[model samples]
Target: MDHLTFKLGRPVTRTTSQFIVYPAESPDAVRHAVRLGLASPEIADGLLSPGRIRLSLTATLVAQAAPGRPQVVALELPRPGVGLDLRQGSAAPAHVLSRFFGPPPWTERYRQAWAEIANLLRAGDVTDTSVVVLTAGEPDRAAAVAEGLILGSYAFDRYLGYRRKPSTERCVRLAGSVEAGEMRQLARRAITVAESVNFARDLVNTPAKDLGPQELEDAAAELARDLGLKCRSMTPAQLRKRGLEGIAAVGQGSPRSPRLIVLEYAPARPRYRIALVGKGVTFDSGGLSLKDGKGMEVMKKDMAGAAACLGALRAAAMMELPVQLTVFIPAAENMPDGTAQRPGDIIRCGSKTIEVTNTDAEGRLILADALVLAQEQGHDAIVDVATLTGEAGRTFGNVLSPVLGNDWTWVERLLSAGLTAHERFWPLPLLAEYREPMLGEIADLKNASQMGGYTAGSILAGAFLAEFSPKTPWVHLDIANTSWSAADLGYLRKGATGVGVRVLVQLLRDLAAESVGSEARRRPRPRAATHA
Candidate 1:
């Protein structure tokens, strides 16, 4: 792991490199400053700019000179009278500053600044740290910079070789008043949470060859053991005995076999029972309705939801929230084989029969069984997360997860929690009328819709899962857009985003509070009968 340290001192009288900024209209002054700044005879002549500045400084210089020892660019802003120093890589120095001042709406501006800085850090191209000096003397601005730098320096590099090492410690220094100890603690906590999220991403990024259905189940079981949670892993035979046809039929094609992973975290005084179901299609080859080459390239991340659920459970156990939690992972790989279920096959799923209209639509089938199992265990509220449909990506475009639920209040609560977690979600309606199209003439319901396909894919999938949770307040998160990122954003890299873990954690916390309050408000009644 890389480390960053900051120090402060008096400004050096001698200058090395200068970056002069004049009034926006004074282009000539900028040219003069640049020319003087590059005046050293040892420096390349082409770098002496007579007029205007180039944005691609490094690329232009590299193209001009024969490669040897790389030249370092040290930037300095010319200021007279009072002097201040910004130094890094040392311990405590005289008057170290760590404070932030921004717009009146502090948190939003703070987040935006962090987002911008995080994007730069993740780019991996720029080697120099950006130093901003504020003359306004606002304490919050300096605090925000320190906070952003602390959060922005997170990276996911678990797969790196032992021989490889990063050359520099990425550092951002703030020049304002703030307590060093408090800032250090804040930075440590931020990095801890970010690393946990990155761990989830690593699990999602692993190839199906290394992490198949059984392997995923084993991983979950190990996690439960490590956290001291009660865990039970059901084999295909056990699941079959429990009448989990949805999981059995979808997993029949894979040699690795399928499993139902149940993990329980019970606190000493439980407030609420919350169950989370995740679609764990470790590798989705689209089954008999095979996917195209481009579509199959990233299918290893199809288990992203399961990864999030497992990650949330780990965080919850670590945080020790006052909630009884249960996690259900229906692990399977949807592949094409001689024994694979066909598109027209009829399967009984948790007391409800489903006609397989498309073998590619396998995620919902697996989740149906998991939801039924959760409800049977007497959970008050159920939530399932999955990268279920391409329609979600088409609708939200990598920005938002679409949430659908039969209970409007629960959906709203989840939406609010997602906002606070920075995991964006849009509440989608579960119209009772949409159930008509899902009705099958030969079976209880059709897995794929005959009409309104792309427009309502998320809603239809939610409706399908809702069948199993007949009495439980159910929420379905179609996180197809958020699970994989086409580009990096903030602390997230351009791979598995680990979308739902934080949101699910927040939701669990909210549910726990609500359950506690509700129980406290109930009136006591006199006992009518006593049996001895």
Candidate 2:
């Protein structure tokens, strides 16, 4: 795939093969066109009218210029309808253009808008674009544009016979007055973060045949070596010797052995130490309790949480964040065979024993040992993400993942980070009563709760893992729904949304800021952002 190269400066006038992009709402777009001698102000204004161009999420007004004039492209915003409401009896008059539409969160809207701009360019078969971002004087908004463009352009067509070739060397030139140095820095940061997200997407989109436990460990080790970080992997024999029977049993049926992949970034004199645990069920066939035919098709995506941690670790290393971080992935494949684990099987997961009430509920069993390993190292906090339940998907429905944790502070921090990254999460209560359903008759707990009959299944899975890290501040993100999209929406591609990676990167950046008492630490983050 070709990555985007960003440049800042005004381009010299050219008649042929020249296109300029502008925000429709910005009067400056028309003024700039007039200044560039592409069109008269009145002509440019007419080009942007609703009747002149069709607009859904976005619209483009393509103008054929005179021999020496450059072609003009205006990016139209959605008219007031559906999501946009007109507030009645407000101080601002309805006729006021800016106030005509109700206030959606401007920051996120800018991000989504720019992502649409990217889609518009792609539709036009334009790989290189000259864009004028109307940030309304906020320079930080420019970074959002860079982020949206990179994310919206992601595609996973590696397995296809004839795939659309991704742009190999695209360029986006920003023509603006923002300080050149600052623009470059912001753009670089956004590029690093978005590219990390795409890396995770690639991992999740890969077929299970090629990305089993050992391959996943190899990917982590390669990342660690490239970034100059520490990497270690534990084989099935080692895992069993170290008292991680849950991980060992889940993969015993498969030809491939399970692996515990550990990656670490330890900065000297670090202010905080954090552990991230991810459930890496490379292929979840539901074990002895096999899934239906249709359900099994997307089982390759079951390891999205592990891909997320790997992506975040890559970003932290590239960005050189100050906090010390460790990532743990308990990689396995849950396939049914003669040697597969069965219902009523009891497995020792570190300090606790779990009854395998349902072999399909295997993600939490592996994560249970990982959480124990995280706490064993005595990190400040632990966050584990997994595609652990169908209930979470049915509840959230690809909108936001559900998060349940032992500590409210850690939960709120994740929520705040999600808002900034635009990869959202919703908090679910970890009720004291939620723990009762997992209490096992023969073991310490049941891997799947039968008493509740699938009621609160997502929280029950979280409660099962929470038993291992009883003392550490822990947050569990159930990302089954958000990890892979059923259809393309906004910046997310059709598959492997790479949900938690951005949230983790943003969280680490926030923690790094708070570590040294930077000015960003004083700025309050919204508990959540309004999702479209």
- lDDT per prediction? 0.65, 0.71
Which candidate has the highest lDDT of all?
A: 2
Put down candidate 2 lDDT per residue, 253-289, tens digits, no spaces. 7989988899999987666788999889999999999
Q: Highest TM-score: which candidate? A: 2
lDDT of 2: 0.71
Q: What are the C-alpha RMSDs, in order, of all predicted structures?
A: 12.3, 8.8
lDDT of 1 by residue, 70-122 (tens): 21222211211112233222221212222232335454345455545544444
Model 2: pairs clashing at backbone N, Cα or C within 3 Å: 2-168
| Model 1: CA > 4 A from native | 1-112, 115-192, 452-455, 512-515, 519-532
Q: Any idea what lDDT model 1 has?
A: 0.65
